[model samples]
Target: MLRILRASGLSSSFTPFRALLSSSSSPDPQRGLSVVFFGTDDFSLPVLNALVEARDCDGSVASIEVVVPKLKDPSAKCTIESVARSAGLRVHVPNRRTTLKYWGLPGAPPPGGSDGDGDDDGEPMEIGPRYDVGVVASFGYLIRPHIASAFRLGIINVHPSDLPRHRGPAPLHHTILAGDTTTAVCLIDVDPTAFDVGALLARSPLDLTTLPDTPFPPPLPVLSSTLAGTGGKLVRSALRSWNATLDAAVDQDRLGAEPSHAPKVSKDDAIVPWATAPAAHVLRLHRAFAGSFDAQAFVTLPARRKPDGARKRVKLLELDVVAAGDPAAGDAAQLAPGTIAFDKPRKRLLVGTADAVGVAVGSLQVEGKAPCSAVDFANAYLRRLLGSGFVV
Candidate 1:
């Protein structure tokens, strides 16, 4: 079962049932291409659905099939299998027998069938009668060179970031952290070894016009879903002519671009050392990780009534950045950075930062508690402080 919980108060309204039109007007799939798609995450759903829709409408694909979702957790819900099966596409799970009972479909590929067949002997086997190409989007596993070579046209990937930049698992997070105003999606030739080092087949730029210079930008999920939609279109376009697209592929190595890496984000990297970091930087971290599981920013605070100085971690979900005021103004200088204060009239909780910036908590959650508005947080934990001059 998939456990659904709000980490950063962001949720995806995207569903795979809906299909967006491709950029190319009236894409003709009569190019005699059969696609074997590999993907796992929700980011891959749109691309999968788009191809299925194209195959249903035009002859864009002679046949469309999918690999069993590369599940991160064996027991977790598989988005790729769920979506592919729902679209009535053939799903192949490596080393596992396929049956109608497996996917709850009446007429799916049977076990030991050619579709789920593998080239374990290092010998390249024909993918299938109509299967000539492969499409991968956000697939968790790397395709082996032998498996990649089996497809007549090889594989193409829909990457969310611009080629040679922000290449890795956390591209969306890194893009927001760097305050990039523009990011793009690219369809590239899969190299099967390096990350996003593939030759480019097509590219589409996404304007992040909503990212604020100081405040939190859009959540990572929203940006990822948007890019996924754009990537789906680009994938569809590439299907129109794989041979021509591959022939026109541009080598990223020749571009002489110094690429920034976005390795997977870790728990330690998500914790905000509020006392040492600038408020602007902290805000960026909050925004960048807003939608990431286990990565929202948190600050350690002393318990209100515990004289023993027992500390509690309060997770920040949403916040606003306020320009730093002169510390010399009033008693502002007397408060230490990370000190909590309340604004009664505005009903906001403000945390002091080293750089004199004030971060007004828009939403927060106590550890092991549901997220609530800042006003609610103050009411629950700082009610007495609210009466005593708004100090916490």
Candidate 2:
């Protein structure tokens, strides 16, 4: 449901998917299941919207409340708030300074406010429930025991990657990084003080073996595309099924867990080090950085003479993974890891990697200009200065 919104990006930065989510579904909450949702990213949009749609399908929300972190920017804040408000969903942006207690129990309101342990940081805390079940999806804030205990059924988080696996931030990136071909969309119950400890109610496998209809290269575009709504659809379907078997949602094993963590990646993490990366790692790096936080396979070039006798450098973006079988692989394999070798007449740019794997450059952005193809990049900016020998 929300995947449609991700596909319709108006700009590279903020996703307008939330812009259309409100109008796409009905505003009524479902009967029986009342929930308090806590989320702050695009990953959480589908489950939240689905909950709203299911409840509002017939024109009335049985019970639902939202606790969203207060985004400093109004555009960002209003995007989700407007969607919720438009759908008649309750939107709760607890004051960080006033609601600081965990679960926001009737205690001294809260230090600084929002809900978490005693802390003076500006970050918002997950103030516990004023509702029945607490549902969190891609919520950046860490919810403490106070918050989880406040809810009768505990909190249910819509984790993108399979739990007991990629258990922290950047699950999708971590999973992709580990090169796991199979993963799951899990709806786990969050027990107090124990993250990933709640019962495993639903596990829907995610197959990443095949690329999407519209393919975006790694390191940047892929992670930022916000194209996981179909995955969310599967989660919504699984949740509905779980609701039927609510009693069966049992606690998972504490042992035998191969836990992994994907801490929030920063701009500094985006800098690619071609000298050390293996082919597989290089490919994975690009995919992990793709959508958000400036995903790209950046390059720096050696000084080469220009028509005006000045040395020129290049910055390349977007690379396609290729194996030894492709016709371009052999030629690409010979170029240096960061060299730019172009077959402009055929519109091909060969990018070599420290690993044996070769990457074919597809789209690129040079000094101050729109994204251009390998052919254009070569003809206009390269070619004369680079007679080959430069590696990908």
Candidate 3:
């Protein structure tokens, strides 16, 4: 039987279903596990889909519910709420983003009740396991200790990078920016105090060499999609062999690998350091952030007819490293870093780098103008400023 708890002002609804096992009992392989799935972005969709499929087809998942962040905009498209509803699954959301920090599992007793100390009313708390397990993927908020302890088994997270490496909010973005040749999707136990420092439950390596058509260091979206698919399979397998995978889990701190951090990508990262960074570095920056909603690489160019050295920001929409044999590449070697010149023969804008190599700009967008091709930018913005050689 399932019981629904509906919120008054928010679109949140919770369906509490009894687990096959008792509160103190371990998961029964024959009966499968009840799951509370927490996720938010596109990367989380594949794993959620896998669990939903498992619930219907196999015995790996008994029941599943989704918990997403409250929708701030009702008309927003491509949200997890819409996706879960379309799949006919019950969804739960917090009243506000900050509410998650004090959130408790649905059907679980309120904090400061019989489960611990009595509440202000001195009423007894209902105590028992609310769900068999919790699974989180790309759910930006932290799950507090009280919320994690409500489940029979603690929360498991699907992290994009290998354990003990790239541990933070923007692992995928950091992976691409670092030009790493290999990465992996990992399933780990969620540490209540920190993020991405969980015990490793499973992992599937993404071999860059095997990606077809594109050269090494493919675009961020391509790599992200591939990793998401792998993560789905890995989590499914872990749940299918629940006991064995749990018993074999290893602590990330004990793993001997050096730890690294992947802080959130910011506007500062979008500023192209043409004067100090190499051409390859700039290319990596473009690949990492070009597809992002806000963070795209940009250069500060001198404003037209401004004696105060006023500058305008031009976003580099598309960029490529100039081959050593290209004529523009040779001409760029003679110019200083941050210097830009229009290559008439190639019909592209070439900019020098710190390494004396040039990078070709395929398309760009001025501060207030629509994106335009390199040829158009050169014709309109470069022709008049050629005497001074429009240096960024």
Candidate 4:
């Protein structure tokens, strides 16, 4: 039976997969399944590594083949590719526009599928021998029927959010920005036309609020790392005796919820509205944008008249919340919102926000300057002109 582990909390152990593997009886471990994997990002590393480790440990997974995006430069470093190669896994960089081309099937779309407008013509072309199953995580491209059909048992994907929710690319960012307390990793049967509409093989929920023991919410990478570990475990469990459990997969649509999409995070999404947005919201934005592909959350502070008479934007990073009316706030209570004040008693730079809440600045980068501590930034630039005055 398929198992569902909901987010009351998460266990750091890989005991779940190990337990399932030990009890397996359906397909003999001696027969051993071969796997072809599709993935390209850092988030996919853990899952791929887990599979590679499994293959090394037992004969359950006989072979590992990886497919990655075509690199513009042959010398470009792909972390997943590097890890896969180090594990002695076979790697293929297939062009999504012409997958069949990689296999010498000219004029035909790739076996699984391509990013083409229409479906393949006539009958589906057959690719060579098929692997037992396929797995994907953050592969960044859709699979066509031809490629999917090449596998005897089709493909399964490790998605970082609960099915029927956050059913898009940037789940990590959206989950944080929305103030979600919990997130889940789902191992789902891949569907070609619709994204993440596949049947659920396994679900492991993670409690985001309980991590890191911090006063504020955990950072984006913290939750991402946790989910990645959970995802890897789920994949291993789904593949063990997969022939038997595949048929038992549950339909996600029946879960009785409409999924909220997590579109790619945009530059506008990272802007910190210190003067207008709620303190919690500002903090969430900072936490969400931290370590993201895009730059960190920032607000443009008013520029002081320089010797050159040029104004520049001050990009802030490492923002943390401080309760209003802290004794160290001193005269900060009298300053306008968005002001930069030094909390001398606490030895931190405090940025005032809406509702009398203060955001402790750990680090910041002035335009055209290297990143520096908040105190260094104030002493070198802010204190001279603004004298701990309004930021804007």
Using all chains and alpha carbons, the TM-scores for the candidates as numbered come to: 0.74, 0.71, 0.84, 0.79
Q: Please, what are the lDDT tens digits per residue for candidate 1 over residues 252-354?
A: 8876877888777775676767667666666767767766643344433345686443444566777666644533223333445667776665667677666
Best by lDDT: 3
Model 2, 1-392: lDDT tens per residue?
00001122122322121221222322123444567777666666776777777566733335777777766664567345667778887777755522323335444244246444445543223343444466677666656433443554445667666667766667777766677776677666554434555566666665555556534332333432233454455445544554443554555574366676666667546545666666666666666656554334443334545333432323345666767688777777776776667755457777667875767767666545687888777776664443342322
**Tens digit of per-residue lDDT, candidate 3, span 184-221:** 99988775445576678888888775798876677778
Find the 10 residues in a row with the least total lDDT in model 2: 1-10
lDDT of model 2 at position 44: 67
RMSD in angstroms, all models? 10.1, 10.4, 7.2, 8.5
lDDT for model 4 comes to 0.66
Q: What's the true lDDT of residue 294 in model 3? A: 29
Model 4 TM-score relative to the real fold: 0.79
Candidate 4 lDDT over 126-158, as tens digits, reads 553357677888777646554554665557788
Predicted structure 3: clash tally? 0
State the local distance difference test value for candidate 1. 0.62
Off by over 4 Å in 1: 1-31, 70-75, 94-130, 210-216, 294-311, 323-335, 383-392
TM-score for candidate 1, please give it.
0.74
Better of 2 and 4 by lDDT: 4
**Clash numbers, per candidate:** 2, 41, 0, 10
